[model samples]
Target chain A: MHLVLFILFGGLCVAGAVNLLLQRHPINSALSLIVVMTSLAVLYLLLGAEFLAAAQVIVYSGAIMVLFVFVIMLLNAGEEERTTGSKAAYLVGFPGAAALLGVLAFVFLSQKSALGNARLGSFLVTTSDLSRVLFRDLLLPFEVTSILILVAILGSVVLARKEQ
Target chain B: MNPLLTFLLLSILKVAVVLVIFLTAVAYTVLLERKVVGRIQNRWGPSRVGPFGLFQPLADGIKLFLKEDLMPTGVDRFLYLLAPMIALVAALLSIAVVPFGGGQTYKGVEIFDIADLNIGLLIILGITSIGVYGIALAGWSSNNKYSLLGSLRATAQVISYELALGLSLVGVVMRAGSLRLRDIVAVQSVHGMASWNVFGGFQFVAFFIYLMAAYAETNRAPFDLPEAETELTGGYHTEYSSMKFAMFFMAEYGNMIIVACVATLLFFGGATSPFGHLIPAFGGAIVQAILPVLWFVAKVLAFLFLYIWVRGTLPRFRYDQLMGFGWKFLLPLAIANIIVTSLVLAIHG
Candidate 1:
């Protein structure tokens, strides 16, 4: 029963994603992306990573998608420019995206059973565990990520200033 | 019915009851907010419906139902319809992961209470984030300049604060050593000198950051520039009316309640009694199981009252101030808190 719901939700997510990409209007695309994020949250629930699902919604849907919509709105590019992408861009981007998806699908299919072995269904990632991993095994990467975020902030501020 | 069938039925019934309670709570919460704000402002809120305007929400519901639910002619009809459902679903979904109470035994069979899941906390965060698209879509689909602007601001506010909010919890997660909400409470139950977490050195700082980030993430008062009525004219849902508008309102309050629940669970040893040692007589299995839940609810309600108080007292931040605070101030403080927490934990261990 759980798997059925997962599959149904996942299917909706994938369809929504494809539709999101196809939709010319930026708003439609943003809304569809939200759906995709939601379905992914559901998938996380089925996997028993409830926290991750919440983070997925709060982060991607709440934050990232909002950012996307904000940019679209800020740009003020309405329906007139929605479907104005070049045919060549579509031809190139679609196939490239498809190839990437195929590789991901192949990886996912091969590792499907192994994923269930992690016992993550009940494996809670507490604050301590996160710190241990972050500070120890992932220390360099963690620091690097922080630097990257700082740079992004700097760049956004600079860009906003340039616009002004 | 067979045992399995009976179990499923009972579970469904429980879920139904929870949903009904949440919806009714959402309705009454609106009424409560009006009354509270009115009393605070030295005015009577809604005294026309029933005694003290208790039935105002019901009256409002009827009025909304009777009113024409019209869609703008130029709008994309599908997305326009979908926005509220998305908001409502995302709003209500967070309740499932929240463990309202502890386990109860039946027939010598100990049933792990509160939808006992491994990653309950993560699920709550994930589902709540998805609600952002609802407002974004509503704004965009409405095809009104004000709506678009409102959603754009709201999305920015939610996302920026969300990062700080999630990162702020890393400190608690470090202390608790488990993602499960129950485990967090269990860990919080063991306190040292001074208060629970608010005085535990860097833990207190983390808690403060979490509190502020949560308020911003939920788009509550003093941080609610996105929906500032004077400026944006209703923000993202400027064009929405009837039940659709109600869904957005409910989602906002529901999200607030859930955030408060997370705060209680993480900081105050959710459901555990304060000074469990004092009550030596009641320190048996029953007390251990029951006290934490009471503690948890009390902690959550305290935060809820704080929310109301802030709403009553504080004025909304300017849009620039809001953004600047999150990026320039809160983000850096959160990072520092995370770094400081790890150092303390390392020394103690």
Candidate 2:
């Protein structure tokens, strides 16, 4: 059951990624990105990271992607003009991608002995438990991350402020 | 009966029953709003069809079903069609986790909610956030400037208000110490109305913030600048007609009811009677199951009535005022509420 569900969402995730790359229209691509994010959230849920899954949807697909769509709509961007010929990129890109995939597979295969199998649906980490780790054990790091985010927000506000 | 088959059939039957009741409730709520708003304005709302327009929703549904579906030229056809379904589905999906009554079972199946997951509150928030897409996409796909502007404002308003809405709920969650809707209600059920999160938990500030943010989130008036009929011509659904337009309308009301249910559950102690168990239980198991549902419905009705009253009374906000109120006022107040709540909890403990 778990494997089937994983395969389903994983396939969907990949398909959405491909569709994102293939789409000419910015809004269509943005929508595809949302599909990718949501499907990834399902995968997180299947892994028993329910909090992460909900946050993933709420933050990524919900907030961030909505902004993406909003910007696309506001800008009224037209479809990208297609160019037929990029011979050098076609020759180099495929081999680079293949090599990357090969390297990833090789690393995973090499680490297979060290990596123990995880039984699906057996592992569970509720939000309370995760909070315990974040709020107590790693409180400093969490606070620091929040501060970093605050700084980023201030930076964006400063940058976006109109000249007066 | 075969066990698996029985389970499947029972689930199917349960879903169908719930959907029928829910949709009927949604339809009537619209009628109730019109009637209530009408009465507020010193006029009869809809007395033409069925006594006092009791069947007005039915008539409206039929009219919408029979109308021509007009597609505007240059509209993005796919997203134009998909948007309403997205909105309606998100509205319906969020309600699945809301517990309408106490745990009642038939053949080992829970009767109230479809799924009472532990992360029910988060799920609802996530779904509500997703629901924005329906409006945003509707505006963009319509190929109309008014639709685009209305949708952009709506998208911005919803996303901005969502921050305060989530923050306000954090106080309740802190008090309950659970994300489960049922658990949150149970926390408040101990002392009935007195023990409700709004009163007993010292979270009334949070409650008010939630109420305001929720009004903005669900696009209710005076925060309803997105569909401000005066300025935006028909807003996001401007290009939509017939059943398609009806779908967006239904989605809006559906979202309103869902918001009302959440308010009831989070702050009003859900189906638990305000009088507490002081009123002695009487009658058979059937009555026991029903009494809570009655209480729940009554609370939701009160909330809906409040929505109507506000809609009738309040003037619409300017776009700048809406944004300023949400960010400058509600957001900070909500944060302060959370701080005070946490401080109180820590000191008390």
Candidate 3:
């Protein structure tokens, strides 16, 4: 069952990514991005990271993508011009892609035992357990990250505010 | 029966039953709103269709089904057609995680909700976030200025309110110490009304903030700037007609029901009776299964009535006022509520 779901959503993720590139309209591309994110969340679920899956959907696919779609819609950026590849692009692109793929495959092969048995797959981390890890074990990082976000928000507000 | 097959069949059956009941409730909620609002305005509402207009929804359904499905000129055909379905599917998906009755299993299958997940509340939040796409896409695809503006307003409003909505629930999550709807309810089951988050938990501020934010999130009245008929016509659904328009309508009412259900579960102890142990279990397994469900439905109905009541009495917010209220007032208040809740919990513990 898990394998079936993995194949289904994994295929969907790849298909959405391809569609995102092929789509001309900015809105259409944004929507395809949402599909890719949602499908990736399903993949996260297949690995039994339920909390991560929910966060992926809520924060990334749900919130961030809504902002992307909203901005695209508001701007009404017209469809992109269809352009064939430049002569220099097809030359360097293929080998670069191949090298990247090669590196990924090498890393996966090296990590096969750990991926098969432990943290990478077939383990459920309940919400409570995840919360403890975040609050207790990773408290400093979480607090620092939040403070960084607070600073960024304050900067944006200051920039946007008008002087009376 | 084989275990997997039994589970599959039972689940299909559960989904079918719950969906039918939910759609029926959505339909009647429209009738309920019209009737209640009419009475509030000193007029009769739809009394000719059946006994007290009970079959009015059936007539309305038939009318919508028979009406022409239109695709206006120069619209994005694919997203235009897909938008209402997206709206409806996202609206319906969250119910699978809301526990409507006891944690009872028959033949190794959960009998209350369809999918028994540990992250039920988060799943609902995620689905709601996705629900925004339906309205946003509807407006952008329509090729109409009114639709575009309406959807734009909706997108901004939803995004702003969503932060407050999610934060308001943190206090409840903190009190319950888990994300499961069942656990949230169980935390409030100890002394019934007293133990409810609003009363014993001293999270009334959170509850009120949740109520206002939820109202905005569902895009219902007072906060319903998206579809303000006075200015935006039909809003994001302006270009829709026939069953397509009805789909948006259903999605709106469906969202309203979800907001109500979540409020009931989080603050009012869900399907658990307010009377707690004052009322004994009255009958066999069937009755036991149904009693909590009855309590759940009654609370949801009360919330729905409150929805209609506010719609009738209150006026729509100006766009700027709506934005300011959500961001400046509600957001800070929700944060304050969270801080107070956490501090109290820490000190008491």
Q: By DockQ, who's the top model here? A: 2
Compute the lDDT of residue B246 as modeled in candidate 2: 91
Misplaced by over 4 Å in model 1 are: A1-10, A33-62, A79-164, B1-7, B47-52, B105-114, B191-195, B199-202, B280-295
- The runs of at least 3 residues in candidate 3 whose Cα sits more than 4 Å from the true structure, single-residue gaps closed, are A111-121, A158-164
| RMSD of candidate 2 to true structure, Å | 1.3
Candidate 1 vs candidate 3: the lDDT winner is 3
Residue A126 of candidate 1: its Cα lDDT? 46
Judging by TM-score, tell me the better candidate of 2 and 3: 2
Report chain A TM-scores, every model: 0.69, 0.93, 0.88
Q: What's the residue-level lDDT of B277 in candidate 1?
A: 58
DockQ score, prediction 3: 0.86
Q: Write the per-residue lDDT of candidate 2 for residues B183-300, one digit (tens) a residue.
A: 9999998877899998887888988998999999888899998898999997999999999899899899999999999999999999888988788889998998988999999999
How large is the i-RMS for each model, in angstroms? 3.3, 0.5, 0.5
DockQ-sorted candidate list, best first? 2, 3, 1
Cα lDDT listed for each candidate: 0.76, 0.92, 0.93
Q: Over the full model, what C-alpha lDDT does candidate 2 score relative to the true structure?
A: 0.92
C-alpha lDDT of residue B31 in model 2: 96
TM-score of 3: 0.97
